[model samples]
Target: MKIEYADRMRTVGEMGAWEPWLEFFVEGIRTQAAEAVAQTNDL
Candidate 1:
């Protein structure tokens, strides 16, 4: 995840590419939401 973040930041900084970073951020949010739902169900 650290490497992936670095790569994403590099693209955003070097090429002014926002889509990849936006996608990555959205996926991370989706993943966290899924985990939260699972944990709530478990509880």
Candidate 2:
């Protein structure tokens, strides 16, 4: 599923109003990934 960011945003907008939710979702994923890496290094 290769889609451009703008395309994805458009689709999401079409589905419903969720811009903030999407932002939080991406941020959460990033934070979790960073935490995972840090924990692995601490081992």
Candidate 3:
């Protein structure tokens, strides 16, 4: 069972129409993404 990153990203894009769900999802994504980027950048 293997899925490509593009497919997963497209699935996430399809979910954007649901605002309530998108809020929580985006919140978590921002926090995690910031942490990941900060770790890499030594910020």
Candidate 1 pairs with clashing backbones = none
lDDT of 1 by residue, 1-43 (tens): 9899899999999999999999999999999999999999999
Ranking by TM-score: 1, 2, 3
TM-score of 2: 0.57
Q: List TM-score per model, in order.
A: 0.91, 0.57, 0.47
Better model by lDDT: candidate 1 vs candidate 2: 1
Report the lDDT tens digits of candidate 2 across residue range 1-43: 2344566667677886477557756887899999999999999
Winner by lDDT? 1
lDDT of 3 at 31: 90
Which should have the higher TM-score, number 1 or number 3? 1
Error of 3 at 9 (Å): 19
Which stretches in model 2 have alpha-carbon errors above 4 Å? Answer: 1-15
Name model 3 segments beyond 4 Å from true: 1-17
